[model samples]
Target: MKPSDPEFQEFAEAANLPLLRTARLLTGDWHLGQDLLQVTLTKVYLRWSQADRWDSPTGYARTVMVNTYCTWHRRRWRHELPRERLPDRAGERDTADTVATTDALARALADLPRRQRAAVVLRYYDDLSVEQAARALQCPPGTVMSLTFRALARLRQSADLHDTAVEGR
Candidate 1:
């Protein structure tokens, strides 16, 4: 089916921004995030009928994106290179504090082990329930709870986040 199919188009339009945000967090790179989102959308397009039948289309898309991300993580060829310099920004200097907090959170997220990061993203960022996150991660709900606890602890312990919080206050 074409991407312009009404059902697929509607789902894509509704879920696009949240999917992109989740993808960016999963991949920790904007370009990779875009690529991931494209792959996700293509997957959704191929399975549009089944996806359309899902109770929560956005949740299904998120599951696909997370699973795809985990697959990419397992493959060595899909490496995300660390950048030595920051990307250029536009002239607007508004919301500097918000930007810094986001950057700090992203960096801390990058430091988390893959499963922990996935759990945190699914549970907190995606606002999935423990049972839901567990299903998405293919683990038990208790594991999701533990992973969320540990991930949040790690983020709290991060000196980068600590410094950002101190400076933001």
Candidate 2:
């Protein structure tokens, strides 16, 4: 089916939620995820007719999402504000621990270099093959592997530090 066809729209709509979830996992903010998704959808729309011919539509969307995210990171400086300072909803009090853990993970993710973060997100979160992620990132597969290894190491170190702090407290 052509990208402009109704079936294409249906497929895009059906994939939206999962795409947003993956975006949020990669970006660590709902607003950023929405923005990323919007950008991705716009790119998909522009290339819709061609996208339908690809072997994997979801992979195409993911590559768009990653490219858009990388562009945003490169062109903009996203200010890092402490999560604790943000206003909380009454309902969220019940899920405070979950929120805290997510916040910790997000902070750790933010600490990584952009390419490393992208490698980690694409390889692990999106479950893309190294070759696929390399294509998406316009890098060699060896580079993707290196970035993934470094990112995982950094995340592990940060997690261990967080655990130690909690235990000390």
Which has the greatest lDDT?
1
Put down candidate 1 lDDT per residue, 1-169, tens digits, no spaces.
Answer: 3234886788798889989988888887787888999999999778876754676777777778878887784432347567899779855667888989999998899899878898998888888899888877878999989988999999999998999999999
TM-score of each: 0.78, 0.78
Q: What ranges in model 1 sit over 4 Å off?
A: 1-4, 74-94
Our tally of clashes for model 1 stands at 0
What lDDT would each prediction earn against the true structure? 0.83, 0.80
Candidate 2: lDDT of 77? 40
True-vs-predicted CA distance for residue 52, candidate 2, Å: 4.3
TM-score of 1: 0.78
